[model samples]
Target: MAVGSASYLELLLASDTDVADFDEPLTQARAKGAPADQLAELERERALALRVREILIGHRRHQAELQLLNDTAHDLAALHDLDAVLQAISDRARRLLDCDLAYISLSDRDRGDSYIKAASGNISGLLRALRLPSGAGVGGMVARTGAPYSVLSYHEDKSIIHTAEIDRTVRAEKMVSLLGVPVVLGRHVIGVLLAAHREQRTFSGRDVNALSMLAAHAAVAIDNSRLLGEARAAADELRVANATTRSHAEDLERSAAVHERLTRLVLDGKGVEDVVQAAANSVAAGAWCW
Candidate 1:
């Protein structure tokens, strides 16, 4: 046997003592010249151990990769600010998937449309300037479907139309593969997460799954940001309204005071001299005469 294979077999044998223990009595009998059957059993046990070791090693590597992905997702969830969250997600997706372009498109719910909120790499500037109506293209279709979609050849895909802005700027129809996943919160689709490769390539199922998970994180972050902004705006309006109400109340109180003084002067039936003196004092104090 080769050195590497021999070492792997040895390690496996050491780790699984039950196999060795079963072989121990057989080995002792063989030492006393018992039979060839006993020696064959020892070789069979060693083979089984090698197989188990290979399976165990494969499982361990898979588990380690899963743990790393989980850690990255937790980090994404920790971000609160909407812009930062989108940017981080886009960056991570681009790096993890080895895509040429990645972007997050947030829906403008009030306008019934969607716009790219953040992007990474050369397409970032182009995405920032683009907006798509609901159900317009791949991103919109993903939003409407609320599911993941992928195209291995975008140029050949008749459904995709290059935005006028993108055509004017990039001038390269180099993008060939595209994938989009909806960002959904509750029953509503909030946005779309997009990834694309420059050359025609089929996206793996794993890539789609990872992008979907990232989209979920983005949806929650966007919803929180919208709520926070609305709350601040409402607080400002309430403050302004309160100030207006107070000003109106103060004006009413001043008018009532003026009316009371006028009524007292009339009710007293003061002589001409007293009335004239009161009028002179009121005029001197800048009171308007009707």
Candidate 2:
């Protein structure tokens, strides 16, 4: 059990690549017949060093997760195209959760189901065209519950109401594990953000929280896009109304000018030919006068 205490101290101050430097020295010391007391103390130091390494790695991982979420928020804020925003969220989820594929499924209250809206890293059309009825699959459960759901092995899981179509599609995509979080807008669950793997993988609480944060971002993006579309439609209507009003105003002004010209000709005792000529000058050739 002999281990290098010096290497243990170095481990605490070392970079990730440098942490592996302890094992070789530790093996050499064990073979050299080091005294039992010294070996025990070195073992204690080695355990402490390992614990420190674990904490350091965990902290770095958490930091990276926060950065990913912050980057997602910035991206959503800058992006106006709904499809691009959705794809960005899905792609970021795959990278953040270290999963093989990620997708966003939107709830259709009208249809009483949730349908795939966007996906990343998916090769099969099955996943792209997937539509899960409410309470049928992991996504559907999340849609109904408005809570996050994680599965270590989806097909084998009996906790959810798995439908044949969803099961068949999941099998075709070769998805083993899954995680879904509700994309909530106000009091309603508008959609679900998901991450999946082809191989069995555990979803940690941290992973769930990260995906949930991104789901919140997705909700805001959807709401903002909806508002923007509405504003554009209203503006278009306003422009059309303004154009119509301008056309009517121009017609009224021309009619008033024609009337004034005819009155002046009558006061000057102009002939019927002069009056007809003045009317023709003010109106288009095909326009009739009574």
Task: Report the C-alpha lDDT of model 1 over 134-206, residue by residue, as the tens digit.
Answer: 6766787788778888888765677655555544433353566889999988998888998888887888787
For model 1, where is the 10-residue window of minimal lDDT? 1-10
In model 1, the runs with Cα more than 4 Å from the true position are: 1-81, 108-113, 123-125, 133-137, 158-173, 255-290
> lDDT by residue for model 2 over 1-290, one digit each (tens)?
33366667666776754556656555666788777776777767777778888898899999999888888888788889999999999999999999999999998879888789999999789987888887888988888888999899998899999888998888888899999999999999999998999999999999999998889889989999989999999999999999999977777776776788799999999999999887887666423333
C-alpha RMSD for every candidate: 8.5, 2.9
lDDT of 2 at 203: 94
The reply for model 2, stretches above 4 Å from the true place, is: 1-3, 12-29, 271-283, 286-290
> What TM-score would candidate 2 get against the native?
0.88
Best by TM-score: 2
TM-score of each: 0.62, 0.88
Question: Model 1 scores what on Cα lDDT?
Answer: 0.72
